[model samples]
Target chain A: MEPWTTAPAGPSSAPEMPSPGGNPVGRVEEVLAQFFMDGKLRAAATDPAYLTLWEALEQAVAGGKRSRPQLVLAAYQHLARPAERAAENAVLLAASFELLHSAFVVHDDVIDRDTVRRGVPNVSGRYRQRALRDGADADTAAHAGDSAGLLAGDLALSGAYRLLRRVRTAPERRERLHDILDEAIFASIGGELLDVELSRSPVMPTPERMCRTARCKTSVYSFEAPLEAGAVLAGADSSVVAALTSSGRHAGIAYQVVDDVLGVFGHHSRTGKADWGDLREGKRTVLLAYAATRPEWQHIAHLIGSPHLTAAEAEHIRRVLTDCGARDHAISVAEDNARRALDFLEHDGVPSPLRAELTALLQGVMDRVRPE
Target chain B: MEPWTTAPAGPSSAPEMPSPGGNPVGRVEEVLAQFFMDGKLRAAATDPAYLTLWEALEQAVAGGKRSRPQLVLAAYQHLARPAERAAENAVLLAASFELLHSAFVVHDDVIDRDTVRRGVPNVSGRYRQRALRDGADADTAAHAGDSAGLLAGDLALSGAYRLLRRVRTAPERRERLHDILDEAIFASIGGELLDVELSRSPVMPTPERMCRTARCKTSVYSFEAPLEAGAVLAGADSSVVAALTSSGRHAGIAYQVVDDVLGVFGHHSRTGKADWGDLREGKRTVLLAYAATRPEWQHIAHLIGSPHLTAAEAEHIRRVLTDCGARDHAISVAEDNARRALDFLEHDGVPSPLRAELTALLQGVMDRVRPE
Candidate 1:
């Protein structure tokens, strides 16, 4: 039911113990839920029309496994001096990351033309269905849904900043948080633009280009920013921040690799997404880049990006990818990145207990993508 | 050529003299221009792909008369203690308002399906043209253009916050600025969503609803927030803030009223936009609401909201609006609001010179739509 559960659930993994904040994941969720409720109430008082957007936003933010939030809180707990105010602010900071993620996902759905997310009708889907029920034509319905989704995303992004502003930290620290958030947003946007360009280009993307795109689009925002923001708020030294950045970058790249793998190989029931989406959309993943260099790929290349790619064609592409060693290469790369991430935690002077918790979380994420 | 030149240029109006820190408008533009140039260089260094987005953003921010920024600086100058750092910070704050305005307009263009803005190819239009020249089909090109536009707006919104964070203000004052910005953004977004809903609904939107939309969508961010943010940064008392808010609300509403009038009757040569857009788009302006109550509207009502509305038909609708007294009524409402705004400035303890300057600015805006 977690938002990051976009990957197929692998082995019932759980954290060993709660951090200093006591169940950071649960606290993050509670904070977000309350935030939405309060926001919805305010909107309702002003105008009921605004309620629809709030409802859509609420759904978008809900049911997340709170992955990003966990990283924020764990990092803060590890480095921050013991202060009650900082502890409270950490929860808010964690919630801000979740809000940011929701914003990205909502917009991503519009770009991907996706109707469902997290195994349920997404924000666009719900609005689209409503428009249809009200007798709007398909085109009108789609436009309405997309517009609403776009607005919802905007609200969430703005809300993230608002939440961060509420964190009762020193002015200097708050200023640093703002810088980190801004850089992440700028980089992620660049990554998305690059992604759109790569998708449309006739030239095959290089593996390095693909990796760079992944790091920019997913790694920085999803991993590095949250980790760094938490550490900065906690007044951690530059070395700790740098170490977390390294760890976040590698883990984030690994996460995207696994995501690409799931798109082709993971079951729909488990991943809660179309299994053939990446191939059908011709997503320029590193796996696809590696396959393009193989002679065997030439035979099925025509079938790869076809909009009407069937289950049989998907199966053929999967088989061809494995036979050409592209799939194994991608999986091995993910494993190597995950190992490097763990190595950072091991060598860095992080507190022992916090280090163990961080290790467990990263391992759990990696396990979700291990080759059967 | 300034974006805030929403009003058609009249008999060459100019400020009497520069404030304590010289021409605030000139300073704001310089800051913004430098910011964009620096941003472009950094983006280019990161990736050439990022350059396209920054270019689009630059165009979007350029040519604005710095209307919102002017309000920010003018308000700040009226009350701020004579401190060198405060003056410098005011310019940065003014630039932030411009950034936020750019963000809104970029997104608004996408929502309105407007390819041209200020009588030129807007961000989406430019990108769409590029995509087509690059061999993408019409649909792909349009989608690509919109997606890129969406990202550009996101960057601008984030960039606004980043710019504000650069303002050298006390922590408490900075917090207040954040609050004002957040509230304005939230209200404007809600107003936009309401506008979309009102447009699509088969029922006639009430005049009250239309006015509410105008105030929320235009007044808060465009008038009220800039004024309030500037005042807050200058450490103005709550009463002064309240007075400015009142002036802003009435003036902002008046601005929208004039804008609605121009949409119908203003020549494209003067307005830099299509005269028939509001009619074709079926914009639910207060003038339209008033016209709907008149019997004369029944004859040509069918012509309104037609996607293929012709120039001749637009001319006929304009005539009908006049004959029914809706156009005159709208203008009178606008004048009344402007009068109310002037009343606030006269009664409120704004400095004499600054008050006179503010009055002249507001009068210039009101004159833009005075009935011939």
Candidate 2:
């Protein structure tokens, strides 16, 4: 089977082709795969053991559709003197984005103590299993789990650097790209650190704070950096850069809030993971916004934090969240953000074709955030 | 008191200065202190929480003498035209070396689950204590310890990249420096993984294989990378680079083996840490070379894995090591490597000043290795 065939949702329902041509998204994925394969070879050469780490990274990159990279290339083509060189830089940028994503996921898995990810044992979890299979005692296996997972994350971090080194653009453009990436990563880690600490404390996570965290941790790199890098390479003016970043910030946060919603209520078949894993883990999300404003939530808040809450109890808590209107309120917030993102893009001078594509992408993502 | 004044071991017996009229090694310590204070301010601007991570990194970096960076600067001075610009590059390089060292040590402590490092509670250990002190339950505290430690190491890793970005050299030279740093980090992690694995299986860590691990893990970055980067900045020839790398390979391995010895029987006042911490933690070192070869040692091989081995038991093992001539063998190996390092520098046309400094630095390290 093709690597993309194994995506949690099998395949997305978005149109494969642009109006005037063939399957642009599929072509993007094909190009991304080849670019990633080359980057993987270079990463593997960092050390012999990185060969194994690279395999894990490939799986992580393969599961995502080529939406982000396609957006970058589409935008670049709209703004730049499109050529083979432009196409090549887009692929390199896409590959670097994938590497950056892998770094975050690997580190996130460790923080979340997640044993399985994307329907496969997470890197650290796999290492733990290998130790057990090797007849290591319990303590040894546990230590091996933590260490291996950590090293795996470090390897991924290094892989992102290696990818950046391969950017064949002008040195000044490359340096700007590097700065954008470095700043985003540093901020993301800080945001993650704040996020985990907030979850551990008794304070109710505000919707505003959650949105801020989402923007820093997920939005910038996920939506803004890729687009900004592409635009910078295309020598887009300051106004275009500002507009894209604004759109990306709002849209990315909306995407994350929607993801949080899906984490609690989406189908296991579509997500390819346990439904309500977030609830089971007591994760704080934007859906808690209504609860924070409601006096009735006090009783349920204590219940949610109860040390002995069972899966059925977690289901009841989820029901209470819906009953208090938090779930719907979160969806509304996400819709507003998505709408704002599209509204911001309308002021930019993006070419008609690409602007239409951006509009559709934003609306499609918003439409999918559902209670279904 | 200034942090340097409280350095774990005051002045470390004042290793003989490498240059007759140059600044004392204390100047290196002062430079480290200044860099750390500036690093703290930069980290605080990013996030106040990062200040904690920076302090942990500073502590780790401060404990070691400025051997490797000094070697790099000394080599640079030998070849480079005397200029303020060159001196600035040398300091930046020295700071980079320290940052790389800090990254390695932070990660190493996590891998080892070390509770105390350089006579202070390790970052992980301190976090665990703080969690418990703050009334976190046992499991929560344990998890916090592991998580915080992992993140702290990541902080150091990120900080290294930030330091590297400031290397204002030719793009080609910068790329070469970047490659050296990247390769050293990956290889060191790989060697550490191997060492941890081998400890559980109880194999004869052959001198050659162990030395190779040292060369890759310690020597290349610690010595070769800095020296090569300096040379590239100074525009040195291939012959100088070759001799430097070869000599570094010998000294680096010898330094680690000597460090392993000191861990077993060194003075508390001089090393500024528990003399037998390695034995208590069951680290497999070259000092075990003698113990592993003894008939008497076979009886206690299982006990070596015990976490609760006492001071007396550790001393007994040390005695067995002395009796088996393994200690003597390790010393001989160190001396041989030291000689080889010097011999490698005995070329017809090396910069005379650099050769003398390299000779002094190698001897200073070798002098600390005691015979059985």
Q: Please tell me which predicted candidate would have the highest DockQ against the true structure.
A: 1
> Candidate 1, DockQ to 2 decimals?
0.70
lDDT of 2 by residue, A275-311 (tens): 6566655566788655778876875777655656676
How does each model score on TM-score?
0.94, 0.88
Q: Which of the numbered candidates is closest to the native, going by highest lDDT?
A: 1
Candidate 1 residues B23-111, lDDT tens each?
46887878888988888897887678888789988987884557788888888887887763367799999999999988888888877
* Model 2 agreement with the true structure over B1-372: per-residue lDDT tens digits: 011111244445445223322523454466567767876786576555556666766766766656556666766667676652456666666666766676667677777776566667767777778778878887677766666677766666765666667768878878877887777666766666556655655576656656665665677777777777767666677788778777877877777777777777776765556667667766666667556766866865765757788878877877877877878888888888888888878875577777877777767666766432
What lDDT score is found at residue B20 in candidate 2? 20
Q: What is the C-alpha lDDT of each candidate?
A: 0.80, 0.67
Interface RMSD of each: 0.9, 3.0
